[model samples]
Target: MIVNSDLTMGEGVIERHEVETFLTLAEELHFGRTAATLHVSTARVSQTIRKLERRVGVPLFNRTSRHVSLTTVGRQLHHELRPAWDDLRAAVQRAIETGRGLSGALHVAFVSPAAAQLLAGVTQVFHEHAPDCEVRIREAQADQILPRIRSGEIDLGLTTLPLDDPDLTHGPVLVREARMLAVPAGHPFARRASVLTADLTRVPLVRLPGHTDIPPRQAGAPPATTAPTAGTFQEALTLVGTGQGALPAGAHARRYYARPDIAYLPISDAPALEWALVWPADRHTARVRAFVEAADTLIHGHGTTRQPPQ
Candidate 1:
């Protein structure tokens, strides 16, 4: 039984069920509908309504054979009680959501240099939203991203798409960079206006390991014969500089990683590199959602429009 704060019951304490029944019936109007809504039988609703009316010493609902409507007292009660109930429910929900939300350190991972740049912007936004929360931004290899997320080593990842995993969910795209070919300055294609996929066979297309398993060269093209070096960003670029092979890269590479020995050639026939935030499907938390929302404020249909190379 609950104390009747609405009505001072000196002799009769109000049962919680009575308030629920009255409010639900008041909203629903029909006894059958109220029963269905409350998952109770029609007889139970009728009995409860009768008991409540007896306690109030008045009719709460006007009933005819065809219809039922709230009485004047019931309307006023509904008006006053509805808002209170809504506010109470909202407060309870907010408390529960806050308790269940992010509380400790969140580890975020990124693969490419472009992803790191995008994540830096996102981190600023995330901090503004959650100033107390610690966000650890870590550089991760392409292959290490999803596995680390699934293993709970990382909370989020910023990586490329065509991520066909059922275990992960990808967020809004943060960048769309044009594909560029990183060629040795000594190569002929490096001087071309724009390179085509057909021109891939004309040079040794170096394969950088730890890529998302997307082929380094177009299908059926001769495999890269550039002397295989340990898979590292600088090592691959060094090979390109030595005229060992040309490498497919994002347009951002030329801007940030520009080198005197390496030339970035725009690939006219290649698709753009799309980057988005990704997280474990089962581990989607309030922090992850908030980070995605923060990213949306920056990227989704907003000011960070793609600017072609100058």
Candidate 2:
């Protein structure tokens, strides 16, 4: 929570871009690099800094022919203004979240039934944290979750872990469920106590549609004999139940989507499935961060609110 007056100085409230330019250049100490980082021209950075100096009634930088450094006053201004600027930004973000109401639409998607349960609990806790914020939930096919978040169609997603990419920001592990193999109830492997990864992919594996790079081939596991294409999680499960193929899944499936025809056998050598909250890198905001924190608390902290990562 912050007050705008704390950021305002005298009658002439300084422009934001100027502050940004000053602070960025202060840290970068290179006009070209600062401009590049800010997506502005070097000339623009110079103009903005000069303007800021005039407004502050002092030289902010000691510029030589080959180099640049923050003047003593500039250093002081950077130290003092940085925190105020952060407060101002936080206040504005809070105001935006508040103006939109904790009731504003916060679209979220989930790909698995276990993730759905965790998200339901997260949604409840998030609502309690910010009653006016509304959480809109949707079912997402495995292949569609990341795309929807990247395309700005959804604010957040509950999906599998290890989605390491530059464009995505994934939160901490919400749940770690043991891995299981979904096979036709009558399959020979279904009768076994457990299946090893070395033998898990001997049969065809139903894959999430649109995901072209299937994993066993990459992970050094037994190569799947077939890669059946399916558009939805249920479709993939149904394919496995009917003997079309097998699918690796979280153990939660045995409870939420148990079927007489579908046998979920433990994968003795498989790693646990880690589900986390994920959102696009650029769209991170107060709401997204707050909701993620709430989720981390409820799911990882066992109902007690936990401090989010710095």
Candidate 3:
């Protein structure tokens, strides 16, 4: 017969190690082997088992010099405690997820044109879905975003993909765009329906800094004249409109700028860019899920009207 005790009636210290030791001994059915597995001496294992039995006020094992077996009460306790321990583990996991600032500040990282256009929509949806969350956005290049994710500097990243890193997790948010040449109204290519990579060879290209990862380089064109400094798509568009040189920007760049002075012409045979949402592989939090869902809704609603880089 077993008597019920109320664990909540008084403060009692139930050390986790005692439970672990009990489970280990139960599995091994031998103190020496169990101690070996636990990296402790056999005497230490015996002491821990004795302590656990005494705490519960019940003998847990029937033992003699030749063999050891569980008492009837011990077998009953094992059945009850094992599942209780499993439930406790699950409860602890849930608590960690809930307590890790699920409703707190979410730091997001993004790039330019998408940052200006889609970010607001994503944030709006996220706020509507998770009203308790506070969001912040940071802008950085495609290459710089992942390192921050690994270091825990940012919660999520919106950028171009094919990261190829095992430590990062990526989800396709929206097909990104290709690098379209933004030219003034009077520029030669502006009169044509579309421009080819070879056409920019002679033009004064207001190219992004040399490190900018635009695709299908102008055939036989000179190397990029300067390093890329314009971090935002808007900055690049502004420079193209006012400067004498032509600049390469994403398809959405034209819409983002909404400038009549400039026109965006596609570059035939250029690589298409992919816009993706990236985060640390280990960061499976509620806030992250909420943010990704909101982003997906916004991009899916936009559809394939914006050509993503292939």
Model 1 weakest lDDT span, ten residues long: 1-10
Model 3, runs deviating above 4 Å: 1-49, 52-95, 98-101, 127-129, 140-144, 164-166, 184-186, 204-213, 217-235, 242-244, 301-310
TM-score of 2: 0.64
Candidate lDDT (C-alpha), each: 0.76, 0.78, 0.71
Error of 3 at 114 (Å): 3.7
Residue pair clashes in candidate 2: 102-132, 102-133, 103-132, 103-133
TM-score of each: 0.63, 0.64, 0.58
lDDT of 1 at 257: 81
Return the lDDT, model 2, position 306.
Answer: 34
Ranking by lDDT: 2, 1, 3
Residue-level error in angstroms, candidate 1, position 260: 0.6
lDDT of 3 by residue, 211-304 (tens): 2436656556665454235655556666667756677666766666668878888887777766778898888688888888888876776664
By TM-score, the best candidate is 2
Best of the candidates, lDDT = 2
The residue-by-residue lDDT of candidate 2 on 1-310, one tens digit each, is 3233423555566776777888899999999999998899999999998877877788999999899998999999999999978877887886776544455779999876666777788888898878877788998877788889999899999887787679998888776667778889999998988887776558888877644223233354545676677887778888988889988777777887789998888886666666678998877777888899888778667653332211
- The regions of model 1 sitting more than 4 angstroms off are 1-99, 212-229, 301-310
Which of candidates 1 and 3 is the stronger one according to lDDT? 1
